[model samples]
Target: MSKARLLLATERRAIVGLAGLYATRMLGLFMVLPVLALNADHLAGATPLLVGLALGIYGLTQAVLQIPFGMLSDRVGRKPIIAAGLGLFLIGSVVAAQADTIAMMIAGRSLQGSGAVAAAIMALLADQTREQVRTAAMATIGLSIGVAFAVAMVLGPLISSHFGLAGVFYFTAMLAVLGLVVLWKLVPPAPRRRGHRDVGIDRGQLKSIIGRTDLWRMDASIFSLHLVLMAIFTAVPFRLVEAGIAEPRHGLVYLGVMGLSFVAMVPLVIVAEKRRKMKLMCLGAIGTITLSLLGLGVAGSGLVALVGWLFAFFTAFNLLEATLPSMISKLAPAGAKGTAMGVYSTSQFLGAFLGGVLGGFLSQQFGLSAVFLGVALLAAGWFVLMLGMTAPKHLSSEVVVLSDEHQGDALETLMARFADVAGVEDVMVVPEERTAYLKVDRSRLDTEALSRLTGVRD
Candidate 1:
């Protein structure tokens, strides 16, 4: 096999390892959902508002820390940051497990949220995989998250029933220990930051990316995505119980619907990617979400709400979850994928935090109807924002390793030459890593031309 092929295989293994690590963390957070309200009162001083604050604090910390942590990973290396984050997560889990008071539980959960690793994982994936295949690698990780989420929701009740919420924390701690092993045994060694070229984003790049109206729209779409997601969960479980399924059985309902929705998302994603119809898919998801929430706002029967609203919400949620990353991947300047994801992830966590807080407040003040109505409005706004977005033409980015000699003036000269290549949209020359990050139009760019100009073969 070729060297590039070997490297790709190695990267794929690393991605799988990382996927397991991600699943472990999410399982800890997700398994609490089925019974948070039921058991929270036992912790003392628990109210709906307090429960909401506890749930939302994780997102709040994650939103604040993910970008800096990700950028830090770029500088210090991926594994160290990942290990440190996982350690913090383990400590938080243990703290929560032993908490007798809601205040302590909230504090533990906040620290757990502070163990933000999404950015580091993404950066690692980017570092290991070439640009041409990075999206596919990313998609693998996304699949893991969705599957873990579904499985956790379904099993939350069963797990809690067997071991209690504290038991869940104990399990999470055990998994964190295993994660440390996986990090060492399975994760590939950090690709030497070549000094050939650096992929790190600076203040100027952030300013440029944020200034683009199109990018802003994409950010808004992500924020809206998570906001709607958290809002649905805020009310959906209660709606399920009101419909007749009891608290413990809600997990079964989530499991069933998510299973079917997971299957459905596959073909829809294939159609969107193959057809290059991201805008259409995005609009369709928003519309579906709006209609679903509207139905929930008006529906009188639990069954009617479940069939009309819950189904619509999950279907749309799964589809949007799959497409949003792809759209961001397409829209971001090729060399700036890390920066794009940093902003995207920050918005996502902020949305989750806001969703939980607002949903709680709305439900407390105006009833569930008001919460659904708010979600409907939010979805409507997303649909409008999406409507105004120009359809993104499909493209891919690649990371090319270069020799250390290609630094300074020589790298700039190479960058100038590479920029003039037909179909190249953006190029970042990193002298530190000896890598050139290239974003290109596949149809317009000549691959052979790139290979010849760069003196490298993929």
Candidate 2:
């Protein structure tokens, strides 16, 4: 099995186009983060609580609609649902741009979030690529998101400074339009697929997925991570302004912090993956976030101190963001990955919603410092929870197509053989699906022999 064979030209096109589409959508959502807090006072009826609601209202809608949108995609085709989602996002952006009141702004943000196409896009990506190369394709999407976040953090303030918050909203609307165009023209059509757990949700497996302690831990980690992220943004801009950094210059701070943090993140990721120190690295990242938040709480009006703490915060954030999804994939059951991810995504959005609301209320009542202290407390709680988590195994799920001839007793024999294969930790053969789900260590697995046994090319 060569790399060229794994990723065909169509697969490459799907990967690049879909990654771009995902990044574009994410940019629209995140571009307001850096400037929203600064501009909130301008909107009519803008109390801290209302401002917080405007910032996080999108997550509430997203959390509510995400699974439903995914289920809808399964019924009416992925493209239609995705196109419709983008349309909803565009409409929301327009509404937000026209909003004069905080309530209207919240409505618009909620509409923007109503376009929940993440699961649909991922399922489409799975349909476009082969299993052997699917992980790489997914990784490309993840990379796109990280890049978009970094770019958005810098661009948000600059755009708002020049054209105002309404202008930023208009820009976001345009991005949504661009996403629709990309979906229609650039992304290839998803081929019909069956029994792919990586692609869509399985209702039957919900109980099992939710019941796993490891999965719950991962879910909680994501929830905590995003909660702190939204909460921090809710207050960080005010601190920057207080520290004498003008709103327009906020991008400079983000550029500096994000650039350095990314540089630091790469080596940590390499060590985590190559050295198999995932749990150690995860704990370290969590600890860093806790300390960074504490520093921000006490740093006061010092620009230098703020920058230093922000640098640490983002470095840890990038590492944790990158590692958590991988951890979920590794920890998920072979045939229930989609269900696990769906739940994980829901938790993440819910956290964003709660974080914004809570941060805003705290800041309003106790001041900006209180918001920082509150988030620090949350991060510390996350750190404590993570301490008891089991270290994730370094394994990849492999699907082997089973022939019709392997039935009943013969299938049982095949399953035994698969389990006996080197580096194969578990094997389950589903006769109804005519596929064998295998958990294997790629580092030690004999791919060639496995391919021979399953009559499939690796």
Winner by TM-score: 2
What overall lDDT goes with each candidate model?
0.76, 0.89
lDDT of 2: 0.89
Per-residue error for 93 in candidate 2, Å, reads 0.5
- Report the lDDT tens digits of candidate 1 across residue range 144-254: 888887887877767666777787777778878888899889888878642212234455578878877878888888888887777656566677767887666777777
What clash count goes with each model? 18, 0
Q: What are the runs in model 1 whose C-alpha is more than 4 Å off?
A: 1-3, 6-12, 74-77, 126-133, 189-191, 194-201, 403-413, 431-433
Error of 2 at 394 (Å): 1.1
lDDT of 2 by residue, 262-363 (tens): 999999999988899999999999999999999999999999999999999999999999999989888987767778999999999998898889888888
